[model samples]
Target chain A: DAGVTQSPTHLIKTRGQQVTLRCSPKSGHDTVSWYQQALGQGPQFIFQYYEEEERQRGNFPDRFSGHQFPNYSSELNVNALLLGDSALYLCASSFGVIRLGQFFGPGTRLTVL
Target chain B: AQTVTQSQPEMSVQEAETVTLSCTYDTSESDYYLFWYKQPPSRQMILVIRQEAYKQQNATENRFSVNFQKAAKSFSLKISDSQLGDAAMYFCAYRRRNAGGTSYGKLTFGQGTILTVHP
Candidate 1:
């Protein structure tokens, strides 16, 4: 089975511009979560989506938003990006009810200029 | 609020030797989950081992094992017979139990521990 898959492996955007990153959850998984990993640091939770609805969010601002589609694919959109937003955006997937181990994807590297 | 901390920013061990990386977390809840993830230069997060808070026995996987001290809220990873492939950045993460039935599966991660296995 394919693990979590993310698109646009690397991206470069200007400050104030918006970008949307995509993620396909692991096969048979329903819950999707996004994390931001800055250089030399571990990933920080951004938000989680379940049943097409956001279930929990971290300390991120309104600029960080996400969507979960019917196919278990998800998108992370950041509005008015800032230089601080440049980081490795990782998407992890797991089953909501079973409390299974998380499967992570190769993250999207976002660089805001 | 929950927080995870990895005191060792970087550690090194010779091949075939043993190394331990320390991690500590703060949380009031008694039931939870702890995880150790390895990220290489490829940047893909890979699960190494996990320990359930309620279990007193340490979790072990082949050459990788964890020392879980629930009372002290300390979780340390010990890699025996280390190999060159073991060189990577290790992350310790925590997740609270879904007490309210809203299981979002959110994870709070510590800074990280960089491990270098010298061959």
Candidate 2:
């Protein structure tokens, strides 16, 4: 009955560098989605992965990519990061694509210098 | 495109009292879902309550309830007998019911409101 879990609670990277954040979805869940929450702001959807394939994406650029493993875990990779990229990266999991209400993780705080 | 808005940036209420947080969203889709998520200082996003567009009855969870107005496109959360633990960042989000393919499971969130429960 574990909830969604994320790794690297906090990270710091310089501009132009790349970073990868990980997430383990809740038990019995198969869909994973990533979101970026900037300071004093709500989370913005990044992308969603289902069945080891990307099923949906937000308005994010190509630099932001993600992958879903067979086990339903996910990784969010941000390449050539900028200072504005610093934010709390959250992961949410649901039973399937049709379930809009998701369970979210504690999130990874990323600081791009 | 769907958009959520929480006009109030911050609000405070005394402990054991009641408080209401406002949330409004813009969407062209007739059928969808609206959600209220509570993010505590620990930064964990917890779902408070949700309402379906097609449901006329408001959604309620324990002391938390929503005032959903489909025509007005408004969804407000009311917390009764609030406690210190109720202090957190409240976010309003929306999702289209007919979403499929690359749009499935995506949520559009509002700017958020910071609720402070005074003890």
On TM-score, the leading prediction is 1
State the lDDT of candidate 2 residue by residue for A1-113, as single tens digits.
Answer: 78999999999999999999999999988889999999989899999998999988999999999999999999999999999999999999988544348899999999987
**What tier of docking accuracy does candidate 2 attain?**
medium
Taken over the whole model, the C-alpha lDDT of each candidate is: 0.92, 0.92
Of candidate 1 chain A, the 10-residue stretch with the lowest lDDT total is A94-103
What TM-score does structure 2 among the candidates reach? 0.96
- lDDT against true structure, model 2: 0.92
What is the lDDT for A50 in model 2? Answer: 87
lDDT for residue B97 in candidate 1, whole number 0-100: 77
Estimate TM-scores for all models.
Answer: 0.97, 0.96
Clashing pairs in 2: none
The parts of candidate 2 lying over 4 Å away from their true place are A97-100, B99-103
> Per-residue alpha-carbon lDDT of model 2 for B1-119, expressed as tens digits?
88899999999999999999999999899988899999999999999998889899999999999999999999999999999999999999998886452235788999999999988
Cα DockQ of the candidate 1 complex: 0.65
Candidate 1 chain B — worst ten consecutive residues by lDDT sum?
B97-106
Per-residue lDDT over A1-113 for candidate 1, one digit per residue giving the tens place of the 0 to 100 score: 88899999999999999999999999998899999999999899999999999989999999999999999899999999999999999999988542456889999999999
Give the TM-score, chain B only, in order for the candidates: 0.95, 0.95
Model 1 regions more than 4 Å off: A97-99, B100-103
